[model samples]
Target chain A: MQVRKIMCACGSGLGSSLMVEMNIQDVLKKMGVEGVEVVHSTTSDVHPGAADLFVVGRDLADFIKDVDKDEIIVLQNIVDKGELEEKLRAKLEA
Target chain B: MAGMAEMLKRENVQIVEGVDSWEESVRVAVQPLVDQGYVEARYIDGIISNAKEFGPYFVICPDLALLHARPDQGVLKRQLAVTVLRRPVRFKEEGPDVRVLVTLAATDADGHIEVMRRLATMFCDPDNITKIAEANTADEVYAFFTAPIE
Candidate 1:
């Protein structure tokens, strides 16, 4: 499947977003998933058409109410590395 | 670059390994410098404490080589001293080798630049990271770190 884009959101748009973006790229590469573009953004900057799926930190979960729940994936903690890959892969496939 | 290996050879540096938790990781990373008496033990604790209170920031993933930090604290800032990338720049599961992300945040951008340059010069040696990861004993790691850099 072709993953055109994936948007990662964090509170500051500096730390967490960068971390998630890097991880996503790694996960995609490992899964042999390609054709995806990853971008980082703050909660305020997120808008439709910016990307297909939005990955967010647990703290910022409430901020993405307007976004469809299916399109939004929230992390309760950062330790779920395996779960992240599975969730993202499922999203990209769908 | 002086590299961590050369730094290990210096009289004032030390290195420790197998640190799994965030607090233990900082303690191990900074303990060598403290043993050589370059930095006071109390000071090292302060940094670890601050990082703990402010952190839970980054988590080393199960792949053993990858790291992920809280998105909120993505851009790490440190006021002084040597810095190691707290977050990994990239991840590859097949290779056991781990890449740590580090940044030095100073009072100003210029300070950050200067410190980064010094660190880059100090840790740029090809075998530096290999030596650090392969080290078996704290003293061995310390010796590798304090060694003079060319």
Candidate 2:
């Protein structure tokens, strides 16, 4: 909600992030949220102000927890609809 | 981009439950692709190696693990294989027990985006995953992917 772009990341950037991106896109669509771009990236590709939100797996989230907690969305299960939707809803409603 | 339903053909699926360890699970998951020349033997090594290095970050959910490495490591093509164990295996100490293994081989960074999307759609739902976990045939499980997303 803060930025139009949401970055989905993993270790190598290309693999699992694609899957998480897909889930995020689907959830955002169902939420009627539009114009938000989901960027698939790796840890190396992420930096300050690189994205509006950083969505990553729990392991990688531990590394990024120091970043803006508001922008960092850590997922225990990348594909869980409830988890993804709830986090996005909280951030957007805030 | 081949959707997951297309990439994960009936031939590429294995339902041999109760694999001894996570290592054996990955080896069984990707062996079909290796035999068909879709991926190199080292692709298996790449998955296991990455899991060791990253501590099963591939364990995407409570019962699922999607394993992969740099496509340049050993991928011969953009493809994937799925293996559902009879019971979950501990991938890491105190981590999630994984029963489903998805070994991914992409030709390049973006090569498998659509396929991954389909998988994300299929596995995202707990109900769908429950159906898949109980499915006895690849077609039965794959039906979940081909079904129109609601």
Candidate 3:
């Protein structure tokens, strides 16, 4: 997988998911990792093969394990750019 | 992007010293918006239910939680309510302890995108969180996000 598409998710899909999406985009841009598309989603809307990567909270990590496909990343603070930068670095590099 | 000061109104911003629980905090924080007819009664129910099902997904940072419900659930408008609690409220035992709750309602998927974008940037600043926590009045809270978006 090329990891071209990323989907961020929270409980309701409206608030925090979008927050994560924007932060992820920021990291990708700062890292100069281009051509990657990031989107927002909810726990119920996620499934296997929907995207190259899935970003979610650790609490909801189990529910999406079936679809994680070895690319489900969990974060303590979704809006913290430092943490996001560190985590996304490994994936974007991989 | 719309900053938090503009996204939230003075009437909707609250400074409560104490709250019973995290769940109650969300309910109480969103009360103003509910009273103002910006959100429906079930919007509260939806936010609580979603939190229960998925844990505290909105605990975006160490001291903040952005409360929300799905647009299809019961949202009638794009509005935000800020409630600052003197004591920290923990949505889940393992989740980040939050001192402020910003209840939000969006009429459509993209209605609140700009506000959320601005908030994501705000959440990146650790210093801003401290300033927000020290704010004593709703107007003070409104002033915290008045700066132009970066």
Candidate 4:
């Protein structure tokens, strides 16, 4: 599956999600991946076709459980680049 | 939008002994912003209500929480507050205990990205959180927050 866009979301769409978005960009850069557009918004934006993938912290995982499991990355630690890189790599490879 | 350093002034950063509960912590963390008219009093309620519904997702990393609510909920301006709890507070029984509550009052979704980026840089190093939490004075905490990011 080709991934082009990813959305990181949280309850307020202000803080945590934005932090995750930066982390996603960092991981993508480190992996030498390009052309993946990343954005952050409220959890309300997590819907089918909203984006190729949705990223959120584990606390908000239930909000996006309805989305395809393959398209959602629920981070146990939003600040951990290692976890994000591993999960992003798996999803990109799969 | 003010940069994170400008938004977090020395007066906005504080070190308190402790609070009775997470709710109180939010209230206390947000109190300075409220007093300065950066946000309305309801903003505190907004953060607490959002927490009640979504759990403490703002506890973005261990021992740290970035407190905020929907901009429309009550934000009057863009600002940041750092409240260091000498005694940590836990938002949930299983959640990490938080010692630093960084209150974020953004006027819109995108205005605070730069500030959040600075915070992301600081939080990426967990020791920064510990350092801020252990700061002896508000001036020290303010310096840690406003210091240029490498």
Q: What would the DockQ be for model 4?
A: 0.89
Runs with alpha carbons beyond 4 Å of true place in candidate 4:
none
Model 1 ranges with Cα > 4 A deviation = B1-150
Evaluate fnat for each of the predicted models and list the values in order.
Answer: 0.04, 0.58, 0.83, 0.91
**Residue-level lDDT tens digits of model 3 in A8-60:** 88787777888889888878888888999899988787888778889887767
DockQ values for all predictions? 0.07, 0.60, 0.79, 0.89
What is the Cα-based TM-score of model 3? Answer: 0.93
Write candidate 4's Cα lDDT for A1-94 as tens digits.
Answer: 6899999999999799999999999999999999999999999889989999999999999877568988899898889888899999999988
Which candidate achieves the best lDDT against the true structure? 4
TM-score of each: 0.45, 0.87, 0.93, 0.97
Specify the CAPRI tier of model 2.
Answer: medium
Inter-residue clash pairs, candidate 2:
B17-B86
Which of the predicted structures, 1 or 4, would earn the higher lDDT when compared with the native?
4
Q: lDDT (0-100) at residue B93 of candidate 2?
A: 77
Deviation from native of the Cα of residue A7 in model 1, angstroms: 0.9
Count clashing residue pairs in model 2.
1
TM-score of 4: 0.97
Descending-lDDT candidate ranking: 4, 3, 2, 1
Candidate 1 chain A — worst ten consecutive residues by lDDT sum? A10-19
The digit string of per-residue lDDT tens for model 4 on B1-150 reads 668667887888899999999999999999999999999999999999999999899998899999999989999989999999999999999868999999999888888888888888888888988999898999999888887866
